[model samples]
Target: MYDFANSGYTTVVITAVFSAYFVGGLAKGAHWATLAWTSALSLSYAIVMLSMPALGAWADLHAGKKRLLMLATIGCVVGTALLAWTPRLSGTEAVIAAMLFIVVSNTFYSYGESLIASFLPELATAQGMGKVSGWGWSFGYVGGMLALGISLGYVLWSQAQGLPASHFVPVCMLITAGIYAVAAAVTFSLLPERAQPRVDRGIGAWQQLRSTWQGARRYRDFVWLLACTVCYQGGVAVAITLAAIYAEQVIGFKPQETMVLIFVLNLAAAGGAFTFGYVQDRLGHRLALSITLVAWMAVCLIAASVTTKGGFWVAAAIAGLAMGSSQSAGRAMVGVLAPPLQMAEFFGLWSFATRLAAIIGPLAYGLVTWATHGNQRVAILATTVLFIAGLLLLLPIDMKRGRAAAIEKSPA
Candidate 1:
C-alpha cells in the first residue's frame, strides 16, 4: 500500500508531468532545461546515496523505521504539494524553485522507498520473496497509472478550457500530492514495523557502512549485485527521467498525449511485474534479471531506431515491462540475500547503489543530449551499453550461494 501511495510521486512528478512542465513550461523550452531537470534529480539521488545507508542503520539500531518513514512520507507529500507554488514565481525564480523543491521532495521520496522495501524479508520467506516483491511492484504500477490517469483527465479538461500549462500543471501537482497523502495514511495505519535489532551500539551506522565496504569480499555476490544494479539501473534511470522529454522533443508528442502514453506504459509495467514475480522464483533470480536486462537492451535499440509515434509506443511498452520486472527482481534478490537482523541496513545499501545509478545514468544522457545539440537518439543508443554490461555482470552471480551466506553469515 505504501508502494501504491508513493508511486504517484514517481509517475506524475518524476516521469510524466512536472518534468515536462519544468523543461517546457517553466524554462520556456530553454536548451538547458533538460539538463537542469536531470541535474536536480541527480542532486537528490546523490543526497540519498550519501545519507540513506547510515539512516537505515540508525533506524535498525533504534527500531525507528516507522518513525523515519513517517517523517519521510510527510516531507515528500508536503514538498510535492508545495510545488504548486512554483508557477506563481518569476520565470527564473520558478525554475530555481522547482529545482530546489524537487531536490527536497525526491530525497524524502527515496528515503521512504528504501524504508518500505526493507519490510519485505519480514513478510515473505526467501523462496517466496520474488513473487511477493513482484506483487508489490505490480500494485505500485497500478497506483502510478491511477495517479497519471487522474492527472491526464484534468490536463485534458484544462486544455479544453484553453488554459495554459501554468494553470493546469500546478493542479496536477496538487492532485499527485493529494493522492500520495491519502494513500500513505492508509499504509501507516495498517503496516507494521517488525524490525528487531542486533547491532553493536558502539559501531555506528557510518562505521558499519565503512566496515561493510572494508569487508566487501565477505559478501562478494551481494557486492556484485550492486555493481550490476549500478550498470543497469542507470539505464532505467535514463528512461524514467527523460521519457517525457524524449517524447516531447524527439517524437513531437503533445503534453496530454505524452501523459496518455505513460499511463498505458504503467499498465504494461503492472502486468510485467505480476507475471515475472513467479517466473523469477522458478527460473532463478539471476536468469530472470538477465532476461530483463536483455529486454532493456532491446528497449534502447528500439527507442533509438524509432522516428514515428507508433514505433515509439512499441519501445515504451517494452521499456515498461523490462522496468517493472528488473526492479522487482533486484529487490527480491536483496530480500533473499539480506540478514534478517540487518534488513534495513542492507536495503539501504541497495538504495545507495540504485540512487548512485540514478545519478550517473541521467547525467550521462543529459550530457550526450547537450553535446549533440539535442540529439536524443545517440543518447538513448548509448544506454544499451549499460544494459549489456549489466547482463554480463549478472552471469557471474550465484544466488544460491548468496542466500546461503545470508543465512550462515559466512562466505559460501
Candidate 2:
C-alpha cells in the first residue's frame, strides 16, 4: 500500500505528466527544461546522498522507520499538492518555483522509498524476498498506471467540456496528491513496525556513518552489490528521468500520446516485476539482475536506433520490462544481504548508492544533450555503457556468501 501511494506521486508528478509539462509548458523549451530538470534532480539526490546514511543509522538506532516513513510521505504529498498552483503564475519566478517544488517533492518521495524498503527484510523470509519485493513493485506500477489513467481521463474530459487544456495539469497534480494521501493511510494503519532495541543509543549520525563505511570492508559482498546497483541504476535513472521528454522531443509524441505510452509501459512493467520476482528467488538475484541489465542494454540500443513511433513503442515495452525487473531484483538483493540488526543502515547505504546514480546519470545525459544541441538519441544510447559496466560488476558477486555473511553478522 505504501508502494502504491508513492507510485502515484512518481508517475503523475515526476515521470509521466509533470516532467514533460515542466519542459514543454513551464520551462519554455526542451533545452532549458532538460537542464533545469537534471539540475534539480542532481541537487535533490546530492542531498539524499549526503544524508541517507545518517538517516538510516538514526532509524536503526532509534527504531524509527515508520515515523520517518510517515514524515517523508507527508512531505511528498504536500509538495505535490503545491504543484497545482504552479500554472496560475507565469514568469521566470514561477518556473523556478515549479522546479523547486518538483525537486522538494522528489526528494521526499525518494526518502520515502528508502524508508519503506528498509521494512522488506522484516516482512519476508530470504527465500520469499523476491516474490514480496516483486509484489510491491507490481503494485506500485499498477498505482502508476491508474494514476496516469486518471490524469489522462481528466485531460480528455476537460477538453470535451471546452475548458482550457492548461487547466488539466494542476487538476492532475491535485488528484495525485489526494490519491497518495488516501492510499498511504492503509500502509500506516496496517504495516507492522517490528521495532528493534536501539543498539547504540549514544551513536551520533557521523559516527554511525563512519562505522557503516568501515564495516564495508568486512561486508565485501554487500559492498559489491552496492557497486553493481550504482552502475545499473544509473542507467535506469536515465531512462526513467528522460523517457517522457525523449518521447516528446525525439519521437514527436503529443502529451496525450506520451501519457498513453506511459500507461502501457506501466502495465508491461507490472508483469515484468512479478515475473522477475519469481525468477529472483528461483534463479537467484545475480542471474536475475544480469538478465535485466542485458535487457536494459537492448532497450538503450533499440531506443537509440529506432526512428518510427512503432519502433519506439517497442523499445518502451522492453524498457518497461527491464525497469521493473531490475528494480525489484535490486531491492530484494538488499533485503537478502542486509544484516538483520542494521537493516535501515544498510538500506541507507543503498539509498546513497542509488542517489549517487541519480545524480550522475541525469547530469551525464543532460550535459550530453545540451552539448549536442538537444540531440537526445546519443545520450539515450550512452546509458548502455552504464548497464554493461553494472553487468560486469555483478558477475563477480557471490550471492550465497553475501547472504551467509548477513546471517553471521546479524544480532538477532
What TM-score fits each model?
0.97, 0.98
Clashes of 2: 0
Q: Could you tell me which residue pairs clash in candidate 2?
A: none
| Candidate 1 accuracy as lDDT | 0.91
Each prediction's RMSD to truth: 1.7, 1.2
Note the Cα lDDT for every prediction shown.
0.91, 0.88
lDDT of 2 by residue, 1-412 (tens): 8888888877777778888888888877846679888889889898888888899888888889999999998998999989988888886877888878988898998899999999999889999999999999999999888788999999888878887645999999999998899999999999978977576577776787798687777679899989888888999998888889999889989888888998898899999999889988999889888999999999999999999899999999999999899999999999988989888888999999999999888989999999889889999988889999999989878988988988895566
lDDT of 1 by residue, 225-315 (tens): 9999999999999988899999998899999989998998899899899999999999999999999999998999999998899999999
Candidate 2: regions farther than 4 A off: 199-201
In angstroms, how far off is 180's CA in candidate 1? 0.8
